[model samples]
Target: MWKYIKWGFRITVLIIVAAFLHYTLPQRDIVRITGTYNRLTEVGANSIFYASPDSGTTTNTVDRRDIRFIEAVYPDGGPMVYRNEDTGWIWPPYFKYDSSNLQAEATNAISPKDKPEWVAVTHYGWRLPIFSIYPNAVKIKAVAGPDVRLIPWVNIVVLVLLGLLVLMLWRMWAQFKERMIEPAMDDLNNTLDAVDARADAARDRARGFWGRLFGRK
Candidate 1:
């Protein structure tokens, strides 16, 4: 039971870590830009996903703000819309203050439905339409075709660094146990043993004196 519980806890932790990385890391989507426009969208309960007030371009007073939208379609004819917004100096740390430039590039890359020009959009975050949350596009570049493969170097490098960090922390903990904790415990045990020996010796001498005085064993 204990073994199963331990395994379950470990699996849960691994799942949580994987989910966090998936949400935080940048992903590339090979898409064909159909249109680019701005809409005055209301920021409400789902404001956490949107850009903050300090993003420099958007106003913070009103609930409605002009949100730049990039309408696109996937290779398999799936519609995917992305919102181009400044990420500011917080959160995911994109520090992206070039939403206008990215929007212009995306607009230039737009092609007709018959002759679709594939573009790679680098972005982070999820697009949940139900919650009115769209992925903020950090950058967009025109690609050769829709079939162009993108290797996720960011994810690879990040995972490698994280693995190294975990290994380093484990090594540090092991060294602490071996060098500091174990030696201190050994000293404590030795001192306890010496005290026990002295106590036994004192008791033996007292018993001998009492036995000799009373003429007992």
Candidate 2:
């Protein structure tokens, strides 16, 4: 029962870590730009997913802001909309202040469905329409075609560093046990043995004194 419980906890932790990385890490989507436009959208509870307001930008009493949208389609002709916004010095750490430039690029890269021109959009977020959350586009570049391949080198390097960090922590713990904890325990055991020997000697001396006083062997 205890072993099963331990395994279940480990699996739960692994799942949580995987989900966090999936949301935080940058991903590439090979999409074809169909349009780019701005809309005055209301920012509500789901504003956490959106970028924060830029410095010196005023907000009305109502939660409304101008948000740029990038309309695109996947290779399989599926629609995907991304929000182009300035992630000004805050969460996700893109430090992207080039929403206008990205919008311009998106507009120039626009191609019709018949003459599809693929573009690789690098972004980091989830697009859950249920929560009105769209992935924030960080950068976009024109690609050769829809079948252009992208290797996730960033993820590979990050995973390697994470593995090394875990290994280093494990080694540090092992060294602490070997160099500090084991020696302390050994010293405690030796002190206990010395105490037992002294007690035994004292008892023997007392017995000898009592035997001589009582004229016994």
Candidate 3:
């Protein structure tokens, strides 16, 4: 049962890390911007996915705030909406402070459906329609064509550094267990053995005295 519990905990941690990386790492979409606008959105269950109220760009309110939105269409005609918000001086560390500038760029990139102008949008996060949360666009640039490929150099470097950090932590833990915990456990086992030996000797001496007094041995 403990073995299963240990494996389950490791699996849960792995899943959480995978989800965090997927949400935080930048990705690119080849699409054409159709429009941009601002809306007073009500924040509720999905508030965790949005920028904090203290984020430099967002309003300081609890339930509702004005949010910038960019509407776009994928090369295949599928629709995608992106939230334009600053990451503030907080977690994930995008440190974006030019949301208005990004919105204007998105506005300038807008194209009609009949004469689509392809653009590469760099963004992070998941768009869950159920929660009305959209991926936040980080950067936008015009592309030559829909077939242009974008390499994720940032993700590769981040993952490699993370891997090295985890490896260093595991090695430190292993060294501590070997050098400190194992020797302490061995000394404790030796002390217990010495105590058991003394107890056995005392028991034998007690039996001898009783045996001699009773002339049983």
Among all candidates shown, the one with the greatest TM-score: 3
Please write out the lDDT profile of model 3 over residues 1-217, one tens digit for every residue: 9999999999999999999999999999999999999998999988889988778555646788899999999999899999999987888689998899999999999999888899999999999998898999989999998999888899999999999999999999999999999999999999999999999999999999998989963
The prediction achieving the highest lDDT against the true structure is: 3
lDDT of 1 by residue, 56-156 (tens): 55774567788999999999999999999998898888999989999899989999988888999999889898998898899898889988989999889
How many pairs in model 3 have backbone atoms within 3 A of each other, for residues 3 or more apart or on separate chains, i.e. clashes? 0
Q: Candidate 2: list runs displaced more than 4 Å.
A: 54-58, 181-217
- Name the Cα RMSD for model 3: 2.0
Name the weakest run of 10 consecutive residues (lDDT summed) in model 2.
Answer: 53-62
The 0-to-1 C-alpha lDDT of every candidate, in the order given, reads: 0.90, 0.88, 0.92
Give the distance in Å from residue 198's predicted Cα in candidate 2 to where it truly belongs: 14
* lDDT accuracy of residue 51 in candidate 3: 87
| Candidate 1 vs 3: which has more lDDT | 3
Candidate 2 per-residue lDDT over residues 53-160, each given as its tens digit? 762123554588888899999999899999888877777777888888999999999998888889999998898989989998899988898888899999899889
Which ranges of candidate 1 are over 4 A from the true structure?
1-9, 60-62, 183-217
Lowest lDDT 10-mer window, candidate 3? 53-62
Structural similarity to truth (TM-score) of each candidate:
0.79, 0.77, 0.91
